[model samples]
Structures are given as structure tokens and as C-alpha cells.
Target chain A: MTDIIIAADAWDEDIEGSLLTWIYPDGAEVKAGDVIAEITVEKLQVDITAPGDGVLSHAINEGDLVSKGGKIGALA
Target chain B: MTLTADQPATTAPARKVVMNRAIREALDWELANDPAVFLMGEDLGKFGGVYGTATGFFDKYGEDRVRDTPISEAGFMAAAAGAAMSGMKPIVELMFIDFMGVCLDPIYNFIAKHAVHTGGKQDMPVLIMAGIGGGYCDASQHSQTLFATFAHLPGLKVVAPTTAYDARGTLHAAMRDPGPVLYLMHKELLGLGLWGTMPEASSNVSDAYFEVPLGKAFVRREGTDITLVGLASMTHVASRVAKTLEGEGYSAEVIDLCSVVPLDRKTVIDSVRKTKRLVVIDEDYRTCGVAGEVIASVVEEIGTELIAPPQRVAFLDTPIPFARPLEKFARPDEDKLLKAAMRTLKHA
Candidate 1:
């Protein structure tokens, strides 16, 4: 399983999590660097990308506040 | 051949540089000159700073000197303090000034008090740099220029530079000084080129390094009808308002209090004395902040001799709202400063 992690910069002192949208749904096949979600932090929208090519599984639901390095989903 | 009086004097043309590049150059100079000076902050190394102020530094200086610390503010702050005490001059970046709360003890209690506590025998030469201010709707937590709060504590030299020139000079001074300094940088003025552009702020900085004395207040514009005093981004705002009011023949003197702690009382008081009317515009909370301090200092120096009570144009005593209109209303701008100046000048 390949876990999709939020970029480390997302948890810098200025940012706080606001999960905006999930572009890829659970069980959707995605390419290794495909942007799977978009998260809002301190008024900036950041795209979360897929870790690998495989079936997608949601580790955390949409609208859930996420921290830096926290796994948002997985490709298995 | 005699130098012709008719010919224009040939002086080196001052190079125009942005605030971030000026800062990066300062860091480059410091790193090359001193072995003790190093930087540590989250995203500072690999990411070249969240605002790009520290870009290209990690490559030049390498990871040892240009470090990327964990997200724990307290942890890195304490480390910086420790390193400074051990004879290393560390330039620490607190991603945002608001996060100072997370590392309050080490910063205010330890690093600030170290010199006095040791009877001047020990000095903590640490520069705590942070991004401050709001306009792009980052909202309450991410936006704030709390220089006054840090200045309130004894032994801390709090400075906020509004232009590329001052940023370079003040930053060099902060790094060299043998004590703790809270160096606040406004995010909007980082010279990102992508964000808000202030041509005046982004230009006119000299290529050669120099220092703007920390405690001095710069008279951005000379006037006599009313005095408009401000710090950080508001300094530019005050200058703009001064120009706008010039159409009506109101000569507004704009004073930039470059360093808050070593409050340049003489400059501020002198301006107020001349104008007989003062309007202080601060980005910080209105109550118990620099605006009040400026007013009190002026009144303390001259009692009942003023033509009008000094006016304060600052953030309302409320948390900055997320919405644009509310934030605009809450924060002081050209319109607010203009009105405050007009109100103060009414009795003059």
C-alpha cells in the first residue's frame, strides 16, 4: 500500500487545515503523481497528489481537518 | 581637466531590489562573513522559506547552516536560544509572529532576559524573524503584526521594516547586535513579484550593504499641517494619505517608527510639537499598543499645550475577521488614516 501524505509545508505555523475537496473517489484508479485532492490552508488552496498507481482508498473523509504528513488516503 | 559645473555629477546608480532579495543578500553577506551566523526554521532549508525570503540560501550555505527544523515552534526556539547562548549567532524564523505564543517562555523569559540576568556578562545574539500582517484574507491566526507586544517586554529590540532598503539595513543590524531582536517582516512586502506591488518599496535599495540605525524614526515625508505616524505597512499607507490630502493643501508629515522598543520618542514628539496635531496609525490592536504609547509619550512631554487630542487609527480591539469587508473595516487604511487626520486637524 502507498500512503498519500500531505506536504510538510502545509503544517507550517501560518497554516491550519480546511479540507476543501477530493478530486478522486474511493476505489478510483489514479496515476502516480495525479492530484487527488485539494486542501485549503490559511486561504491558499493546495493540491494533494496520489502516491502510486492503484485502487484508491480514503484514509480520512472529505472536510476532515488534516495536519502535515498525515495520510489522507492510500493507493493499494 | 577641471570637473565641469555644467555636467551632472556621476554617482553610482542605486540598484532597485525587492525586500526578499535584499534580505537574501543580507543573509548571504552574513553567512559569508561570520561562521557563527546560521538560520533554522520550518521549510526554510528545503523550501527556501515559506515566503521565498530565504530562497537559494540552502543551496549556497548548505543544510548545516541553513536548517529546516520540525514544526514545533517551542522546540526550535529553545534550540536557537541554546545555540545563541553557546556563542553561536543564530537567525531563527518564527513562521508567523502569532506563533510566538507557542514559544513564549524561551523567547521572552530566557533569550530576552539573559543579558540582564547575567549582569551584561552574557548576551543572546539571536534574531527572531517572522512574517506578519493581513490583506489577502488569511484570517485571524495567520495575520498580525504584534511588534508592540514583543516590544512591551524589556530587553527585546522589536523592529518592522517597510521597505527593501530598511529591510536590508535593519536586518544586518539585528544580526550583529549582541542581544535578542524581534525582526517582523510584512508578508505583502516580501517582493514576491506575484503578490501586492509597491513600486516605492520594491525599488531604490543600494547594492552595497549598510545599516539603518534601529531606534531612529524615518520621516518618509515632511509636512506641518498634521503628523501621520505609523509602522510597517501602515507607513506606506500614511505616506499615501499624506499625498492624497496634499490636494486639499493639508501637509501631512509621515513618520515611520522603524523600531518599536527603542521608540524614537524625539522624532515622534518633535513632529507632534511642530504639527500640534497627531494621528497614530498602527496595524496592531488599538488598546494598550504602540498608538497609545505614542500618544502618552507626546502628552507626557507636553501637557495641555496641544491644539487637539491625538487621534489613533488602528485595528479595532477585535480579532481580524475572515471576510474581506470586515477585515478592511477592522484594519486601518488610507481612508481611516485620512479621516483620523482630518478629525485631529479640525481643532488645529
Candidate 2:
């Protein structure tokens, strides 16, 4: 399975910010480049988008902390 | 421009007192005094302020003035901007300053940029209030002091009152000021220690809402040896260090940038020029912070006046941790501030 793993900001040593909220849920089909989730790193917030089109699964839930290069979710 | 309470074409009067209570009291008085003044935010009303700040205010002023909103900082903050444009003074409180990440767009895009966005003349009278820093075990989510986020913005007037006296006074000024005001109340400053406990707070505050005036800096302690520029709560710590520095025969000037947006650049630059040395203290980390801006401004305007490179005594570049020791390690204390000051003295 090809995994679309979302990475964190370049400056984040660890994935410290949470996935604020997900615009899409697990098993949801999404188009490429669709904003799937909101991420907060060092008080800087950015959106995590779908890298590819397929069944989407969220690796982190709302308020759940993740690390840099950490998989926020996957499009398989 | 004085707006009246509950009556049209009437004017509210002004009075003086400690700073902390000024904003809420002004909000209360303004809401009571002005029919246009209303408050809406997360846990604002019955929670009597998210910090029990507006305690017993709703009872006296009614729910309209003391509104309790859903846990939607972005929604309410934006709504506040809209309300102000619609002719209401809405005091919007973000649950915590760290939560700015959730709702900054409305503040930055809609409120702050509105005047320019509207090509000037349209004013937003929204006063966004919330406390930065942790009361105790608030940990990362609640503990961050992110005034630098607001300070970095051009249109937002960021006010951090170190004492109750300034808190109340500056708040009064913010409410009356003709733009968006970020009125941050520190969790520690909530109980009114500067002028004694709440209820017995500075009797100097008046029922008549007055203006504290924006873009003004307060020189808490005056000295000729060195100049220290501190923004918000860090100003308090800077004041403490200044006292110790005085004991060491070094006189320092503690300048509080009451309104960060309209930074009292004259007060700061003039002080730096006189002392020939400068140290900046900010709660945010060293990089891209208020200190960075202050240092740049001083160097750009009067680089020749420096005794040495201006020093920044700032929080270590790290997230505020849960442990006391770790938190202390991250934050700038008296020792670090004094050390930075002493190092700057070498330049002179």
C-alpha cells in the first residue's frame, strides 16, 4: 500500500503540535491536495492536505500531539 | 469620542485607579453606560470572566453586557469584529493566548487589517481580552505567552499590563481607543495584587469610563546607567532585576511598552541614547520576538548611541514545559536579566 504520510514543519524538532481538527474522517475518500487536517507547530498553524486520492486514514486525532516527519494520516 | 451608557447622545465620564481592574470595570461600566457595549466570549458571563474576573458583573450589569459564548474563539472573535462594525462594543476573550492559532485570522485579517482593508475610516471597536502564561499546571496547551504573535501584527494594539493600576487604566484606554485592542490579562494579575485584593482594588477607578491613552510608555523606575525595554509581564520581572541592579550601583530604566503595536519608540530610543547601553527583556524566545524588533529599531535609529551591542534576556528557545524547574529554566529570571544588563554595561 502506498502511504501518504504527512510531515510537520521544518523547524519542529519533535511533532509537538496537535491536529487541531480534521476536515475529513477515516475511510473518507478525498481528492489530491484536499486539506485533510489542521496542524499547530510551535504556535504556527498549517493545513495537512491529502497527498493522493484514496481511502484516507487519520494517524492523529484532534488535540493529539505528533512529531516532525510523523505521519499525520495516510491516503492509501 | 465618548459613547454613553444605555442612552443615545449621552457621554460617559472618566476616573483613575489601578490598571488590572480597568478593562473589566470599563467593560462593565461601558456596557452599563453604552447600549452598544456588549461582551461575548468563551466562559465569559457566569464564569464571570474565564478567570472569575467578571465575577458578579453579570448580576449587576445583566447578561447582555456579560455574554457567555461557545468554545469558539474564532467564531466569537470574528463575531466581535462584526459586532463592533454593527455599532456594538463587544469584549471578545480568547480562552487562552496560546489559542491564538485557532482564531488569529479574524483578528489579523478582519479586525486589524480592516481599516486598511476598508481603505481607512471604518473603525472596529472590538476589545479582545485573554490571559497569557499558566496559573500552575496548565502545561503546554495553556501556558504559552504569545503576545509576540499579536505584536508582530501591524494593526492590532497589544496591551500587557504588569500591574493592576495599568491593567485597569490601559483597559479603559483600549475600550475608548478607536481600533481593535488585544487586552491581555495575565492569570497571576487576575486577583489584583498590585492594589490589594479584588473588591478592595484601587478605589481610584471611577464609574465614569475614561481613556488611559494608547501608544504611551510607562517608565516604572528611572535611572541613568542602562535602559531595559520590557513588554507585558516580562516588564514586571525586568522591574525586579532593575532593583537588584540598582543595589549593584547600576541605575536602570524599566520602560513598559504599554501598547506594543504603537510602540513607544521615542521613549525606548531616547532612553537607549541616553544610557548608551540597552537590554531588552521579552517573554517570547530570543528570535523574531519583541526584543528583536526593539534591538533592530534602536540599532537602526541610533546604532551610534550604543555602548555595546544591545542584549536580549529572553526565554530559552523551548516550549514551556510542565515541571517547575524546566519552566523556570525556560523563562528569564532576575539573574539572567541582570547578567544581560551587566554584559551590556561593558559596551558603555
Candidate 3:
């Protein structure tokens, strides 16, 4: 399984973001570089893309708070 | 690395937002445009509200406009009423609908009855917002959706929005109205990450100012077999059950009663007229709740048109329990709604 992480370097370290929505539903097929989820940090939204092609499984639900470098979902 | 400014990602073209953001946007727009509009609540400034609905207002509009108050609901509520009477629009946020018990006097007596008592000389344009809902084990005190209780009072417009789009629009409408408006925001639907998300409640909301006219009910889904009427969180439950019933060859129409006060009897009556079956769902207590009011209104208007006896799915008339199992049992759910719909269908 390849983990989809909200890269720590993407935003300020002190800020916490929320997983706004998962563009693709859980257990759906996804290709590498597919924008799988959207997270909002400090009113700005950042899209998380799939690292590798596989079935997408969400590690957390939408509206969940996330820190930098967290695994939002995985492709297995 | 792709960060967009206040916009949803390009991959998903729709500008969908959760209810919390939608409410904040509406408040921001009002605060920027209307000098008379101000906000007062506990922890509204800096803390950004309990549900994060007023996240950056303190910085955006300053403390004078986004004022935080002591933990006295009665004091601030009375103050808000006084401010409204003096030609100021005050948006007061009572953290929980359950908290209204301590401040009911100022609300019902002064705020609600100001215009009528003064013979239309004074207009109470106070917009009161409160959190309502129970699914995440917040216990009885913090969770009851007392929609009917507020609606029972005279001269108060009660609004309970189900979607982010409606939340924004209805809030704008409530603020603009020259009368007292009670806007109840469901805790679970706020998308605050404290409770699980209800994706169905989130929708594409525009950034521009808009108003969903007060006293109108929205038909979420159109069908002919049975009509399921719900408000706030119950609307979601009704919609889910409607989808499930559709698989079994049942067409269930879902109506979201956006405002409960001017209770849109026409929408309910029209939908029931077509379907000939009615199942009203509400999270509030069963006795004298919105569910009973809706059923009574429908039957009163078109008793002869009904093919089956109307059913109501609402919270059992008891204080909401803290236990997860008991809370689940007490509140209305998809199962209860589905069963109620089936009971209506049995007569057909």
C-alpha cells in the first residue's frame, strides 16, 4: 500500500488543516497523480494527489482535523 | 503544493463548502456591508465560536463588531434585544439550543413580542443563532433540537437550514428581516470535525450574497409514493431512507422545511396531495413537535386525500439520554423513518 500524505512542507507547521472532502469515494480505483482529497489550512485549500495507482482507502473521514505530514488516505 | 485562495480545488469544479464556512461567509458579508450589524456571544471573538463559525471575524472586523460576552445568556440576550430596539442588528449566538432555558424570558417576552407589544412602533431585528442536534454523545443538556419549542412562541421566525447553501442564504435572509429570527444550526451538520461529516448537508454555495426567502420549504427529492418531511438533521435521515425505499420500488418525496415558524404548510400539503402518504420526521420531542404540527396541518387541509394514515417519526418524549445506545434509541433515525414510511405504505 502506498500512503497519501499531506506533505509537511506544504504549509506552515503551526497550522492545522481539515480534510474538506475526498474527491473519490473510498475503495475506488485511483491512478498515480490523481487528486484524491482536499484539505483546508488557514482558509486555503490544498489538494492531495495519489502517490501510486491502487484502490483508495481513507484513513480519516471528511471534516477531520489533520496535522502536517499526516496520512489522509492510502492506495493499495 | 497546489494551494488555492478560498476556492475548492480545480479537480472538483464545484465551490462546495461545509455549513460552518458558509455561515461565516454570510456573516462576513453582512459585517462588511452593514454597519449596524454586530455579533455578540460567548467565545465568539478570538476563540472563533464553539463551532468555528466566526473564525477570523475578530481580526477581520475587530472586537467592537465581533464582541465576546460573559457566560450569561440572559444578560447578553437581553442586551441584544435592547440593541435591536435601538436600531442595531445584533446577531447573538447562544452556544447550544439547550442553553435557551436560562434566557427564555428575554427571548419570548421582549425580543419576540417587542413589535407587537409596542404596536409596530419597535422592530426587533435580532438574529439569534444556536446549535441543535444529538448524535455524538454530547448528553441531554447540550443536544436537544428544541425546534418546536421556539416555533411555539409568537412573533419569532424560526429557521433550520439543512444544507450549506441554505445555511448561507437563510442566514442572510434572517439578518435582513426586520423581525426576530431564530436560526438553529445542527451540531453534526456544522462540519467542524468534532462530529462526523454529513456530505449530503454540504453543497456548492456561492460567495455572493443571497437570500432563501423565509417560510419556504425545499423539496430535496421529488417522488410520488410517499412524502417524507424533515428539518435540519432529520432532513438528511429522511433523504437516506427515501433512497433506500427507492430500491424497493417505492418513490418517496423528501421535503426540507427550511423555516419552521411560517411552517410551509403549502409545500407539505402539495407534496402529500400528490403522494397520498405522509411521514414526518423530527429530532425534537414527539409531543407538539414539528412532526405533529406538520401531520396535523396536512390532515387538516387534505384529510380525504390521504390513502393511508400519516406517520410521525420523532424523538420519544423524554430528556435526551447520554448513553450512546439510549440516545440512538430516543432520537429519530433512518430505521425509524423507513419503518414509518413502510407503515404509511402498508395502508396502500
* DockQ of predictions, in order shown: 0.02, 0.01, 0.12
Residue lDDT tens for model 1, B100-200: 88999999889999999999999899999999998778889988888678878898999999898899889888876889989998877775423454545
List model 3 lDDT by residue over B77-106, tens digit each.
999999988889999999999999889999
Q: Kindly give the stretch of ten consecutive residues in candidate 2 chain B with the minimal lDDT sum.
A: B193-202
Q: Output the number of the TM-score-best candidate.
A: 3
lDDT per residue, candidate 2, B1-348, as tens digits? Answer: 455432211331222233334455566666666677777777778867655456567788788777888778888888888888888878877868888888878989999998898888788888888777653655687777776777876888888776655676677678777788988776654543221122222233444545566788888789898998877666777888888988888899999887777777888988888888889888776778878888898899999867688888877777778897787777877788888898887653
Ranked candidates (lDDT, high to low): 3, 1, 2
Best by lDDT: 3
Candidate with maximal DockQ: 3
What are the lDDT scores of the predictions, listed in order?
0.82, 0.71, 0.87
Q: Cα miss at B73, model 1 (Å)?
A: 0.8
Q: Model 1, residue B294: what's the lDDT?
A: 92
- For A1-76, candidate 3 gives per-residue lDDT tens digits of 8888888787865789888777677787878887667676754556688899898898999778898888887889
Clashing pairs in 1: none
Worst 10 residues of 1 chain A by lDDT: A38-47
